[model samples]
Target chain A: MANVRLSSIKKSFGKTDVLHGISLDVASGEFISLLGASGCGKTTLLRIVAGLESVTAGGVEIEGVDVTRLPPEKRDIAMMFQSYALLPHLSVSENVRFPLRMRGIGSREEQAEKVAAALETVQLDHLADRRPRQLSGGQQQRVALARAIVSRPKVLLLDEPLSNLDARLREDMQVELIEIHQRLGLTTIFVTHDQEEALSLSDRIVLLNGGKIEQEGTPAEIYSQPETGFASNFIGSANLLPAEIIDGETGPVAKFSDGQTLQLALEVSARGPVTIALRQEDLSLDANGDGPKAKVRTRVFLGARNRYVLGLAGEPLRALTANDVEFSAGQSVGLSIDPQRIRVLPR
Target chain B: MNDRTESLLLALPGLLLLVLAFFMPIGQMLILSVSGPDGVTLSHFVRFLSDPFYLGILWRTVRLSLVITIICAAIGFPLAYIMARVGPKLRLWLVVMVILPLMTSVVVRTFGWMVLLSRSGMIPEMLRDMGLVGRSFALMQTEAAIVIGMVQVLLPFMTLSILGVITRIDGRLEEAARTMGCSFLQSFRTVVLPLALPGIVAGSLLCFTLSASSFVTPNLLGGTRIQVLAASIYKSVTQTPDWPFAAAQAVILFAGILLVLVPYIKMTGPKDG
Candidate 1:
């Protein structure tokens, strides 16, 4: 395993700048995730690291080698494409042996052994002789994974590899990925838009938005303490309400545009107009609780929990509550949340 | 009518056209090839097979067709690949350029080749000036002339066939290969070429069949002495007026093309099925 350093990496498609001088240093054996929505340049950043895309003006140093101008084949890295991109002409065993064969990793016998071992790792040894088209989607994905790890390159880059799998398979693959990472200890850079996947898999999450790093932190730190409104909103789908922080009788209260007031932490330094991010799961819905009142607009049944979309001060607010709670449309419910959970940000 | 009968009715016009226009002539040719004054005989087939001159013409046709097909594939595969990879607008222009010869009359195109390939023509004169050949060098009335003329006419068929398949291949496969430690050329060889085999095979079949059966280009370019099977067949029908022998040669040519095609079809057909 080796550390990957991308210094001041800038990329542009003609005049439209996609990545605006982003720099990152990943530790050896660390699993770093580049997380963002579609068209947010997360995939582009991952491609740049993989040497699949040329950097406009930056240096890419893998294991301090400064391979900025090197082509992808010259770089000691393996990438699993989002589509799996398995060579359809090759059988599963041949597909898994491709990187080792191309990289000249070992003798023929050694390559075959490594291929068998990699297939075993993904629990796909029985299907080694079958072509990629003969395999199921999940099985194809596993073959892709086996091919990627077979050579054991310095870095493994996965571009939303689990996105195509169904929910159960994705979860299973995610667990398998964690186990593989733990066992192999390969320095991996995973690009994904799914927040939960990034949070669950990565040692560090680098959140990207509009070609720039929005936030970078541990999953818990990012989840519990998102620094920006975008961060809070993106991470936990928090309800961002435009409000004013003013002195109240009890503590600092967030006064909404329509004069609805919600309690904030007493240590909140922002005085005037600010946007407060309230996580959906952090808020409680009640009929007559002593808190800010909101009219329930819609209720969605989500098995164990019910998500309520409420209107507070002429703005949509979402809150997750227990399945036992039942609130109908136009029902006025008290929205109670811990003052500490309110993340106050500058508007 | 029932659904099956209604569908058959819908297809009746095409079936009638196929029977009247296509199969009728072939049936007539087969009948004429075996017909004799006394009875059905193998005399025509025996006469053509026994004669080395007629056999040489057959061999020349098959050999030249193989050569032309190989050359077309050698040039067409890369051309198709470039056309497939380029922008759609550019690809359209390239395709039009490749197919422009086909838009003209085959006789006219062959005459164009004749002009450039004759003794004092532009190509021969240039080669003579460059000292690449003897003083009396001429490209006209040679197998080389026939190949050059035929390749120009048949390249579009080969190129477009391969282009249809190559364009459908996911470009990500090449990129994935590159990431898996393949160089650019290695990626093309290992990934693109193998996936494009069906198109290449299809194009080869078309090129081979067309070159083998083509009479106008070879007759015009290769002249009377260097005879291909099609030219000899034409000579037999028109000059000597030996209808049965001409039909026999035609059947032989048809059989040879089918002989080459069957194995190829079998190779590619089952994998897809």
Candidate 2:
């Protein structure tokens, strides 16, 4: 395993910048996820580390060796493409052994053994002789994973590899991925857009937006305590409302534009206009209660849970409630959230 | 009408045309090939097979065809691969450039080569200037001339067939190979080449058959001495007035192509397992 350090990587296509002076360091044997929506430069950053793309201005050092100018083949890194990218002409075993065979890692017998072991890790040893085309989508993904790890590369780069599978298969593969990473201890860089996958997989999540790192922290730190409105919005898709924080003699109270006041955490220091982020699960809905009143727009049934869309202080809000607790549309409902759960950010 | 009868009725005109225009002439050719002075005989076949001169013509035809096909493949594969990988607009231009020779008349294209390859032509003149060949060295009227001419005439067929296949190959395969420690050339050889075999096989079949049966290019460029099978067949019919002999040579050429193709097709053909 190797530690990768990307220093101020800037990537651009013509005049449009994709990654603007972004720097990151991944320690040895650490799993780092570059998480963002499409076109957020997550894949480009991963490609730069893998040597698949040249940085416009940056230095990539792996194992303390400056490999900025090296090609992917010389970097000793294996990447599993989102498409699986298995060689259709090769059988499953041969596909798994491709990296080993290409890099001349071991003798024929040794390579064969390693390939078999890799396939076994993915529970696909039975289909070893089958061509990639003959296998199902999930099976092909496993073959790709096997090929990636067979070489025992210094680093493994995965580009949204699990996104192509169905939900059940994606969960299975994610669990498999965690087990494989723990067992092998390979320095892995996973690029994905799925927030849940990033939360479950990465040792640290680097959220990207507009070609720059928006936030980078542990999942709990990034999720529960978002530093910016974008972080709150992108992470849990929390509701954001423009509000004013005024020193209301006791501590701080948030005054909504529609003139509804809500208590804030006592230790809060900010005393100007700000944005309030409320997690959907944090808000409690009632027919009548001691909180700001909201008009129920709709209630969506989600089998195990109910999601209520509400208009609060002229802004739309969503709150998750137990399936048994419900409210009809256009009805006035009181919405209450604990002051501790509210995230106040500068407007 | 029922489905089968309806299909047959729809195909009736084509079937009638095939019977009258294709099968009848072939039947007449078969009868003519076997006809002797009085009765059906094998003299024409035996006579052609026994003659060393006729055997030499057949050898030259097969050899030149193989050489032409191999050359076309060697050039066409890389060109087609480049065309496949390039952007759509550039690929379109490359396809047009590759097909430009085919768009021209074969006689015109052959004459263009003749002008360049003749003793006093620009190519030989440049060779003289560069001190690469002797003053007496000429490119025209040789096996090399025929091979060159035929390669040009058939490269489009080879390139287009291969291009159709290469473009369908997922480019991500090569990128994945690279990350797996394969150099660009290694990836092309190990992954791209094997996947493109169907196209290569198809192109080789086209180039070989077309070059083998070629008459104008070889006849015009290789001159009278270097007689390929098709030119020999033409000579038999028009020059010698040997209808049976020409028919026998045509049959031999057909059999020769089949003999080469059957094993080739079997070797590269799709496998079930």
Candidate 3:
């Protein structure tokens, strides 16, 4: 296991820049996630670290060695593509042993042993002799993971490897990934666009937007305290409302453009124009309460929870409620949220 | 009518044409092969097989065809892989270049080879100037000339067949191989080659059969000294005026192709397992 440090990496295609100048330092054996929406260059950044793509400028150092100009084969890294990219001609055992065979990691007997251990780790030992084409999607994904870990490279790069599986399989693989990381302690860099996957997997989440770092922190730190409206909206998908904060006789109160006033947390000392972001699950909906009155525009049934879209103070708001709390469309309801849960951002 | 019957009815004319045009000639040749001057006999078959001269010609034909097939495969595989990996526009250009020789008539192409391989040809002259070969050297009227001409004529069939298969191979497999620690060429050899075996086998079969049966290029480039089965069969009928002997040779050629093909088809045949 080793640390990966990327300093001022930038990539561009012709006149269009995909990644702006960016820098990041991942400590030894840390699981760092580069999370963003599509076209945010998170995959590009991961590919650069894997040596699959060249940096337009700046350096990539793996285990304190400058490997910026090295080819993927020369770099001590293994990447798992989202497509699985298993060799169709080889059996599952051979696929898992490929990195060992290519890198000349061990003798034939040792390679076979490693392959067996890797397959057992992924719970695919029985299907060792079967070709990749014979395996199902989830089985193929496990084989890919086995192949990536067989070499025990300095760094493990996964490019949205779980995106192809179904939701249940994704969850299972996520837990498996965590266990594997714990057992092997390989410095892993996972690139994904799913915020929830990033939140659940990474020791540190580096949120990216428009090819630049928007925020970087632990999942709880980033989620609980988003610094910008974009970060707030992207992370929790919170509803942003333009507002003005002023010092009141008490602590501070935020006034929306529609004239609804809500108390702010004492920690928020900023007064003047600002934006308030309220998470959907943080809002509590009641039919007979004295909180901010809002009209329910739509309700989405989400198994155990129902998400209600409401129009509050002339702006749209979303709140998650228990499935038992039934509210018809166009019905006016009161919405309440803890002042601590509200995130206020400067305009 | 039902769809199956209707489709068969629509295909009747082509099937009838094939039976009349293809099967009828083969049937006639089979009849003539068994016929003799006095009565039906196996004298022609026994005579051809027993003679060292005729046996040498048969041996030469088989040897040359094998060499041509191997050469075509050697060059066609990497060429097809390049075509499959390149951008679409370049791929179109590559396809045109591969099949360009097939567009020209065989007689013209053979003459072009004759010019290039002759004693005074550009190739021999350049080699002599470079002191690589003696001044009396010539590539024409030799087995080397025949193999070269046949490979050039049949390379397109070999390459395009493989290209069609290689393009359908998912590119992600190579990328995955790289991450698995394979270099670019290693991935091509290990991953792309095995996946493209069906195409290679198919192309080899076609190249072998076509080179075995070919006449014009081999006749012109190889001259009268080096004779293949097709040229020998042609001489028996046209030059020697021996129709029965010619028919016997033709039957042998037909049987030889089928003899080589049955095992090949079995190797690639659909698996009931």
Candidate 4:
């Protein structure tokens, strides 16, 4: 494992800039995720790290060696594509042994041993003789994983490798990934738009937005303390409600467009117009209590829980509450949340 | 109608056309190849096989065709790869350029090669000016002239076949190969070449058969001194007016092509099957 440092990497496609000067330093053996939606250039950043793409401006350093001009093969890195990208002509074992064969890692006998070990790691030893086309989608992905880690390169790059798998397989693969990362401790950069995958897998998440680094932190840190309006809305999909904050008796009061007022945390220093981010689970439905008056638009039953979509102050707000507390559509319900749970951001 | 009978009915016209337009003439040719004045005889086949002149013509035909096919494959593969990877507009232009020779008359194309390849022409004169060849070196009416003319005529078949296959190959596979520590050429050799084997096989088969039996270009370019089996067959029918002997030479050419193809097909055919 080795440290990967990307210094103010800027990439432009002809004229439109894809990645604005973004600098990130990843320590050795750390799992970092570049998380963003489609067209957000997260995959581009990963490709840049893998040397599959050229940087328009910044420098890329690995293990204190500047490799900005090097090709992917010259760089000691392995990448797993989202499409699996297995060679259909080769058998599973041969596919896994490709990097070793290309790099001339060891003698033929040693390469065979490593191939066997990799196939076993993916629990695909029995299918070693089978071609890539003979395997299922999940099995092919496992073979790709085996092929990537077979040579044990200095850094590993994954471009949404789990996005293609079904939900159940994705979870299983996520667990497997965590176990493997723990065992091998390879410095890995994983690019994915799935928030849960990044939160569950990475030591740190670098959230990308419009080709720039929007937020970067540990899962809990970024999840619990989102400073920007975009961050709060993107992560956990927090509801952003436009309101004007004024000094109240105990704390700041947020006055909604419908003249509904809700108390904010005492530590909230913003005293002007701001957007307050309220988590779906934080907002509670009250029948008689004095809170923001919200009209119950719809209730979606999600087995153990009910998602109540409510219209509060001419804006849609969702509440995730227990199935036991039932609310019908068209009912006027009071929306309640703790004063401290309100996160105020500039409008 | 059931699926099988309906399918057969739909294929009936093509089957009838193949038998009438293709197979029946081949049958007539086969009968003519063995016919003598008295009755069915092996005399024509025997005379041709015993004569060293006819054997030399056959040998030269096989050798020149093989060279032309190999050269076409070597040039076609890289050209097809470039055409496959280029932008669509440029790829269309390259396709048009590769196929433009086929669109013209074969006699016209051969005459075009003849102009540039003659002793006093641009190619030989340029080579002499550059001191690449002796003053006595001449290109006209040679085996090489026939090969060059045939290669230009047959290259499109090889290139177009390979391009169709390469176009369908996922671009990501090469990228994956690169990440697996393969250089660009290594990736091409290991990943792209193996996958494109079917196309190469198809293209080589086409180039071999077409170059082997082609009459106009080889006859005009090589002239009478250096003659292939087809040119020899043309001479037998037209000059000597020996219809049976010409048919016999044609049969030999057909059999020889099959002889080369059968072993090649067996070598590259499906392993398990």
Candidate 5:
């Protein structure tokens, strides 16, 4: 496994810049995720690391060696594409053996042995001779994984590899991905738009917004201490409400526009106007409570919980309450939350 | 009265047209190939096969056609791949460029080649100026001239046929190959070439057949000194007024092409192989 570094990387397509001078460092054997919405340059960054794309201005170093000018074949890396670009002409075994063959990794027998072992790792040993077209989607994904890992490249790049699968299959593949990473400890850079997938899969999530790094931290740290409005909203579906921070008798409290106030946790050192980020799941709804009274605008019936859209001071805020505690549309309810759960970001 | 009969009845016009327009000429050729001054005989076929001059012409025709088809394919594959991958505007321009030669008359195109390839033409002049050849060197009235003219005319057919298939191929396959550690050229060979084989085979069939049967370019460029099988057949029918011998030679050419084409068609069957 190897660490990958990108310093001041910039990419432009005919006057419009996609990646605007972004820099990142991936630690060795660490699962780092570049998480962003579509068209945010996460996939482009992954492609640049794989050498599939040229860097407009920057250096790409892998394992402490500068490889900005090297072609993909010369780089000691493997990338699993979103489409699972298995060679349709080659059988599964041959597809797995391609990198080994191209890199001249081992003897014929040795390559075959590695191919067999890699296939076994993906639990696809029985499909050795079958063509990729003959396999199912999940099986093809496994074959692609097998092909990527067969050579044991220093860095593994995955570009939304699980985004194509169905929900259940995606979950299964996620588990498989975690298991494989744990077993091999490959320095993997996964590019995905799904926040939950990034949070669940990566050791560190680098949140990208408009070709720039918005935040970078562990999942819990990012979820709990999102520094910007974008990060808070994108990461944990935090409801943002403009509010002013005022010093109370004990500590600072965030006062919403409607005169209702939520006491801030001791750690938030903000005095001026700020945006209060309260997660949908973190806020509790009760008909009888001493808190901000909001009218239930809508109630969506989820399997295990009811999501109630509340109108708070003329702004819409959503909350997830347990299914047992039912709330009807247009009903007045008090929205309460643990002050520690509130994330205060400077406006 | 029933669905089967109704379907057959609906197909009757097409079947009759095939019989009348296609099979009738072939049947007459088959009969005429054996007919003699007195009665039906094998004299015409036997005579053509026995003559060294005729055999040489036949061999030259097949060899030149093979060379032309190979050259067309060698250039067409990459050209078609590029045309397939490029943007729509660029691809349209490339397609038009490839087919422009075909839009002109074959005789006109051949004369253009004659102007470029003659001793005093630009090609030979450049060669002489570059010290690549002697002052007496010429490219006209030769098999090479025939092959060149034929390849130039047939290249569009080969390229278009392959382009139709290559464009339909999943482009992601090539990207996949690249991520699998394949160089661009390696990806072309391992991914694009195999997927485009059906089109290649089809284009080859068209190139070979059209090159084999065409007489205008070869007749104009190769002149009387060099005669291909089609030119020879024209000589038999028009110059000598030997209808039976021409029919026999035509039958031989047709049968030889079919002999190669039948197995090729079988190879291009619906099975994956």
Candidate 6:
């Protein structure tokens, strides 16, 4: 295992700049996730580290050696593609043995032994001789994972490898990925657009926006304390409301456009126009409660809970409440949230 | 009518064409091969098989066809791969270039090769000037001349068949191979060549069959001195006016082609289906 460090990497395709400049350092055995929306250049960053893409400027150092000029084959790294690009012509056992064969890791018999052990790791030992086409998507994904880790490369790169699985399969694979990381202790860089996947899998989540790092922190720290409006909005998909922060007798108060006011935490020092990010689950709805009032526009039944879309000062705000709480359209409902849960950012 | 009957009715014209335009001529040839002036006899077959000269012609035809097919595949595979990977506009232009010779008449194409392969032609003159050959070196009217002309004539068939298959191969497979520690060339060999085998086999079959039966290009480039089987058969029909002997040779050629094709079809056919 080795640490990977990317310093001031810039990439451009033709005249359009996709990655402005990105610098990140991942510790050995750390699982770092590059999470962003489509077109955010997270995959580009990962590819640069994998040596699949050349950097326009800057250097990539792995294990303190500058490998920016090296091709992917020369670098001691293995990557798993999102498509689970198993060679169709090779059987499952051969697919898992590809890296070992290419890297010239061991003798033929030793490679066979390792292949069997890797297949056993993925619970695919019974289907070793079957071609990739004969396996299902999840099985193919396991084979890809086995192929990636079989060689015990210094760094493992995964490009949204779990996005192709269904919900249940994705969850099971997520748990398995965590276990594999813990067992192998390989320095892994996973690229994904799913915030939940990044949250659950990575030791540090680097949220990117518009080809720049928007925020970087542990999942819990980034989730509870998103610093910017975009970070707050992107991480938890928090609803943003335009308001003015005013110093009140007790603490800071946020006044919306329609003259409704909500109390903020005492530690908030922001003044003037600001956007308060309220998470969906943090907001509470009550029919006979003393709090800021809003008119309910619609309520969607989500089986375990109901998500109420409410109109607050001509803006739509959504809140998740218990399914037992019933409210009709056009009904005026009280919206309350913990003062400390609101994230205040400059508008 | 029901679906099966309707489909059969729709296919009746094609089926009739196959029976009349294809099987009728083959049936006539088969009958003629066994017929003689006095009675049905195996004498012509026995005579052709026993003659060392005729046997040499048969062996030369098979040998030249195999060489041509192998050469076409060796060149066509990489050319098809390049065409598949290039941009569409460039690929279209390349496809046109590869197919241009096929659009011309075989006679015209053979004449073009004759101009280049003859003693006074551009190729031999260049070779002589470069001191690569002796003054007596000549390419025309030789097996090399036949192989070269046949390859140019049949390269399009080989290239296009492989291109059709290579274009469908997922490029990501190569990228995955690269990340799995394979160099680009290694990946092309291990992943691409195996995947493209069906196309190569198909193209080889086509090249072999076409070159084996082709008369004009081989007869022209090879001259009368270096006669292939098809030219011999043509001589028996046109020069000697021996219809039964020609029919017998044609049947042998047809049978030889099927001998090479049946096992090939069995090997690759079921996998695709």
Cα error, candidate 1, residue B84 (Å): 0.9
Query: Candidate 6: which stretches are off by over 4 Å?
Result: none
Q: TM-scores of all models? A: 0.98, 0.98, 0.95, 0.97, 0.95, 0.97
TM-score of 4: 0.97
Best by TM-score: 1
Question: Where is the poorest 10-residue window by lDDT in model 5 chain A?
Answer: A261-270
Error of 5 at A74 (Å): 0.6
User: On residues A1-347, what C-alpha lDDT tens digit does candidate 5 reach at each position?
Assistant: 34898999999988989999988888889999999999999999998988888999999999999999988877899999898988777899998999898778889999999999999999999989998889889999999999989899899999999988999999999999999999999999999999999989999999999999999999998988999999999997889999999997769888888888888887778898988999999999989987789999888889899888999988899899899888788899887899988988889
User: For residues A1-347, what per-residue lDDT tens digits would candidate 6 score against the true structure?
Assistant: 34898889899999989988888999999999999999999988888888889999988999999999998898999999999989988889999999999989999999999999988888999999998998899999999999999999889999999999999999999999999999989999999989999999999999999888999999998999998888888888899999999987788999999998999999998899999999999999989877789999998999999999999999899999999999999999988899989999888
Residue-wise C-alpha lDDT for candidate 2, range A1-347, written one tens digit per residue: 34899899999999999999998889899999999999999999988988888999989999999999999999989899999999998899999988998899989999999998999999999999999889999999999999999888888999999999999999999999999999999999999999999999889999999899999999899999999998899898899999999988668999988888888999899988999999999999878787888899998999899999999889999999999997878999887889999999988
Q: After best superposition, candidate 2 residue A146: deviation in angstroms?
A: 1.2
The sequence of per-residue lDDT tens digits that candidate 6 reaches over residues B1-273 is 899999999999999999999999999999999899888988789989999999999999999999999999999999999999999999999999999997888888899999999999999999999999999999999999999999999999999999999999999899888888889999999999999999999999999999999999989999999898899999999999999999999999999999999988987786631
lDDT at residue A97 of model 2 (Cα atoms):
87
- Interface RMSD after interface superposition, each candidate: 1.3, 1.1, 1.6, 1.7, 2.2, 1.7
* Each prediction's fraction of true contacts recovered: 0.90, 0.93, 0.76, 0.86, 0.62, 0.83
Q: How large is the C-alpha RMSD of every model relative to the true structure?
A: 1.3, 1.5, 2.0, 1.7, 2.1, 1.5
Give the C-alpha miss distance for residue B21 in model 4, angstroms.
Answer: 1.0
lDDT of 3 by residue, A84-146 (tens): 888877889988988999999999999999999999999999999998888899999999999
Question: Comparing 1 and 4 by TM-score, which wins?
Answer: 1
Spell out the clash pairs found in candidate 2.
none
C-alpha positional error of residue A81 in candidate 5 after TM-score superposition, expressed in Å: 0.6
For DockQ, candidate 2 versus 6, the one ahead is 2
DockQ for all candidate structures vs. native? 0.81, 0.83, 0.65, 0.72, 0.59, 0.71
lDDT of 1 by residue, A223-267 (tens): 999989989999989999999999999889999988889998889
Q: What RMSD does model 5 have?
A: 2.1
